[model samples]
Target: MTRITSERHTDILNGYKSGGSRFNEWSREMLGDFTLLKWGWGALSMRWDIDDRFIMPDGVMFGGHIASVADHVAGLVAMTVLTDSKERFRTSRLETNYFRPLTAPVAMIEAKVTNASKTLIHVEADFVNGDEKLAVRINAVQVRRMTG
Candidate 1:
């Protein structure tokens, strides 16, 4: 596999950040670190604050937020390898497994692109709280529009 070069990837990431409204909005209002920390053509890593709005009444990060984060990460990962720039992939499926209670005040999510093809891409992620693993996930058979 060809590794993504830092300089070239940075360019793509800078462009991607401008369009990352779904996460930026959430980060600003909820996580407070809307500033993107890392990105490339095919991957991104981000952190969000565990503020009260994001936390459950039980003092854990809410499932809804975790799921949304997963969706964003997975979708973006799939988009990175697309051969078509004019079209976006649509999520055909997504599933998140809450392994342990995410009771910690802060959650960190890491998403990766597992496979990519002309028509399908698969992505996954894990949500961590300090040393604890809160979730393991696989999502979205993002289908690329085929062009002849």
Candidate 2:
């Protein structure tokens, strides 16, 4: 199976224009300073600068930040399909593989729902900078609990 590249799924921009302001505001509220770069269908993307507020001694984006992006994107994907039905889930597993180091001050992360099922959803996400894939993440199971 061919993996989806970062640029293809999530495009980094100098800013947002096409309703990006609304997305930005919503994402900021949902995820603090971590801005929403873009989102569509079952896909969501974000960015966070390696500023003083979030920097490690070894350098690179914090693991928490990466995880946050994963959760945000996955939640957004769930929201996409969540209509009148009230669906809830307690994520059982979330995993990631850091492929490259981010030397850039800022890094962009994106997540996508590869498969959506009745009881479980499969998701894969990635963090990248410029043209390099920094991290790869996957959420195996999203057990949709019935809310009666």
TM-score of each: 0.71, 0.64
- Evaluate candidate 1 by giving its C-alpha RMSD to the native, one decimal: 4.3
Q: How accurate is candidate 1 locally (lDDT)?
A: 0.62
lDDT of 1 by residue, 12-76 (tens): 45655774655466546653443345665566675645556666777767677777666766775
Evaluate model 2: give its TM-score.
Answer: 0.64
Give per-candidate clash totals.
1, 0
How does each model score on lDDT?
A: 0.62, 0.57
Off by over 4 Å in 2: 1-32
Alpha-carbon deviation at 41 in model 2, angstroms: 2.3
